[model samples]
Target: MPTRDPDGIRRVTDAKALSAMANPFRSRMMDALKVDGPSTASGLAQRTGQAVGSASHHLKVLAEAGLVEEAPDLAKDRRERWWRLVDPGTRWSRAEFADDTAALTAAYAAEALTLQRQFERTQEWNANAASVPEWDAAAFNSQNWMRLTPEELGELSGEIVATLLRWSQRTVPDDGQEREPVFVFARGFPAQP
Candidate 1:
């Protein structure tokens, strides 16, 4: 989830903003803001089960990166400062890496490793469970061959993003659900020679 302005538009788009989100703690803080609404540093710490100092540090980093903004403390608590996501849909691209093939390749490798680790952790948890029906309910990876022009591929990418966003918005059942966080990653490019 992202924090949106009154017009429901994102406001952050730059390398610094993107790098801010690359850190796990800052990213988690953004998630907290999105799911729980505006909060003070202490409130976010409580909600995310993070230490107050750690949360404050990350929040400050996010604020410096323009990913979050300090809001007015209407509660009359002078010591506490409220913060909110600047725009939930904010995105950034590493313009400096636009022509760096090695850097791009490294980024892809890092993402793939992250996905693999997530899968392995889930498998470990499932192995210990007596019945893992919910685990089975999720889909992991998919790849296919498609004959399409570059423009068509771009359209397909947009469609996939929309579908994934819809899925993310779906409500999960709360019947004692012990769900693990799952990551979904999809990458497509020209086939190798």
Candidate 2:
């Protein structure tokens, strides 16, 4: 299903497990856990705008797929339950699911959903950009068309991820500078338009 890599990412390679995470609600829950750390179903429900029962069901599904796990230690009592991402991040490649039709379909769905979510988040940021003057200089988007061999593309992807990991793992300074979670995502693929 999902194997932990040396980079601490969960590489999902199974159709069933991938399908489990393909749901819109489940995807949001996973994001919430990744961003905010371990949380109860009620907390996730609030963050994701889902009902408590719906959140619990999706969390169980995600746990069954090994994408998330129960955080018993974070629970305050027997009635309380908490969940956290099994890894810092997840990665899946369409090439990995090329052989199975069902897997390919699931992969496509997950990719499309992710792209849509990213676009929506960016749109929200754009709409509210005027209110955050401090971030105006930092917010950015860039694109360039280039030709590269598949091997070169792979290497480029690896390098980009390495750079992101460096930033992601750095500790925030104790200087009390105002800091907030910043959303960052990247995609590189062959395209002509």
Best by lDDT: 2
Question: Per-residue lDDT for 24-80 in model 2, tens only?
Answer: 999999888877889999999999998999999998888888888988998779999
lDDT of each model, Cα atoms only? Answer: 0.67, 0.87
Q: Would you list the clashing residue pairs of candidate 2?
A: none
Q: How close is candidate 2 to the true structure, as a TM-score?
A: 0.95
For candidate 2, what is the lDDT? 0.87
lDDT of 1: 0.67
TM-score of each: 0.61, 0.95
- What is the RMSD, in Å, between candidate 2 and the native fold over all Cα? 1.3
lDDT of 1 by residue, 87-142 (tens): 74553223445686655454444345445655675687568544666556654557
RMSD in order of candidates = 5.8, 1.3
Runs in model 2 deviating more than 4 A are none
